[model samples]
Target chain A: MSQVLVVTSGKGGVGKTTTTAALGAAIAVTGQTVVVVDFDVGLRNLDLVMGAERRVVYDLINVVQGIAKLPQALIRDKRIDTLSLLPASQTRDKDALTDDGVARVIKELRAKFDWVICDSPAGIERGATLAMRYADAAIIVTNPEVSSVRDSDRIVGLLDSKTKKAELGERIEKHILITRFDAARAARGEMLNIKDVLDILSLPLLGIIPESEEVLRASNLGTPVTLNDPTSAPARAYCDAACRLLGQDLPMVIPNDRKSIFEKLLGRRAA
Target chain B: MSVLGLFRLRGTAPVARERLHILLSHERSNRGRPDLLAILRDEILAVVAKHVSVDHDQVHVTMDRGQIVSRLEINVELQHPANGPIAAEREKAAMTIVHQASR
Candidate 1:
């Protein structure tokens, strides 16, 4: 069976959708068949992020409602042959998805693909819960802030209670992906540090994506940073995260600009 | 003075000390732990009262580090009317409140 990974965050605009796209592209590049499913429903931003917005004929709701088949709804990525996207509906009908229908679709996807990556909507609501209901594992994306971390805690609680694994008494592996990490801000005590976020979330770190202009630039161009600029810092971080997801032991690097001024001043004073 | 001593002195100076005090206070108040503890205490009291009489004064709910662990010492007190036969029923409610608060 394929591994179903849900990219979720209780707070919005924390790179859950971007992480889903980047990780999906990265995993697909490894010769594995990967499908990135957008469960954002009305917002439907993942297709644009994946540069498949123009190719979206049928969406996730159509597939679930039996109006369209999986193959019809799945849009193959033009850049990467192995990667595909199942876009979300533009309609605002919240009741479009049924529980049993979603389960069946996930089961079918599991049989067909190596990795089924679901991009969950923001907040701990029905859209978010249903996206994660069938997940075998989760990437809990969070920003380096108290509100985002606190919201992530709520999502973690939901993952423990609402997932199929949780209902069946099986363990669903969860990893924390801290995105938009500004080392300079962290050094200046403006944003939460990686260590502080880890101490609060207590989940194993999957990746630390630094706040970079590359992410915004790539998103504007309808491409994931990992694919748009593979050599960029954010791209490298996402690649490392993908490797970690495959159970590789990659050494963690403390993003560069996190050196504290106190330490620097002390060193200078000593010298 | 040694460089380390000077650093320590700087760290403990009035300006740094004031900054530390203000920052610590802000962090603590913004943590939202107290609000969560209050909610937990209310929920616990509601559930416990369904089984036995609980001493409200003895209800202790506190957060340590970032986890919410509550202790409720319920002193069951039964009072019978003078005109009726004194009877007490023993019932155990199987409700466990496991609260793990984190941020």
Candidate 2:
């Protein structure tokens, strides 16, 4: 069955778009036909991040409103033929995304694509809800911080109550994808660490992406970190996350950026 | 352990983690569930405190629903104080809270 996955974090700037783009592209690289749908209307950036901004002719809002067909709005990845993007409208707000309209678009995409990944907007509003409405599973993108983790917990409650599967008494699979983790800082007790995040949310771990400059550069260059720097720390983490999602029983590799030879052995001592 | 690590005060992470843990649990308990969970935990601690000096961190009150039954389970680590009217007071409290229905 084609799985619809929503990449969501209730808090903004926690890398929902980045994860959506990165995970989608990585999955596509593995030969699966993936369509990443941007649900963050009025603040669309999936196109820009996925390097399809120039190619975005018709967007998700257009498809939802019947202004354009699903194929017309979907922007295919130039590099990865298996990857495509359904960009969100920049001028129109989420009010244009009616429930029935979104359901039709999602249903059509489901029949054609192997993976329909929705990039949800921040907050518990209409856009966020509709993004996860038809999802078979969810990737709760969370940062290792108090506000992000707490917001993720809020998202979790919504996933259990507000989603289609939840409404039908069916369980929706949820995975916690922790991003921008700074192990050194975590050890110093500067903010919530991996263990703290896992304990607080109590969800199954997906992958831990280390805080790295390449992630920002990829966003700026309109490329996913996985494609931009696949061998880099964060990119590797995303790839691992993708593989794990593919049911590959891969061991979890917590991305640690600290490379100091002395501190490496000490492991949180210098931190 | 590094000598400096041993001397260093617990960092902000623990404080943040503890706060988030309490906040999320309380928030979660409010959705289709009683809002009294947070209050109940505190009240239980207060009632228990009148007799035994219990550490606030040592108590855990949680709700769990199995296939057949949903229960509010309370787990507490009893601190055996050096000296006090512990046994009689505990028995009296237990009778009032748990055994009162029979009476």
How far residue A127's Cα lies from its native spot in candidate 1, in Å, is: 0.9
The regions of model 2 sitting more than 4 angstroms off are A256-271, B1-8, B33-103
Question: What digit string (tens of lDDT, one per residue) describes model 1 on residues A1-271?
Answer: 5899999999999999999999999999998999999988999999999988889899999999999999999999999999999999998554787889899999999989999999999988888999999999999999876668777877887898898899999988999999988876677555677877776668999999998778988999999878997877888899999999887999986443233688686764211
Residue A139, model 2: Cα distance from true site in angstroms: 0.5
Report backbone clashes per prediction: 0, 0
Chain A TM-score for each of the predictions = 0.93, 0.94
What lDDT does candidate 2 reach at residue A219? 89
- Tens-digit per-residue lDDT, B1-103, candidate 2: 7999778768878888887876766567566665444456577768888877766576666664322333555666665555453533322222112211111
Instruction: Tell me the docking grade of candidate 1.
Output: incorrect
Error of 1 at A57 (Å): 0.6
Off by over 4 Å in 1: A254-271, B1-103
Candidate 2, A269: how far from true, in Å? 25
True-vs-predicted CA distance for residue A89, candidate 2, Å: 0.7
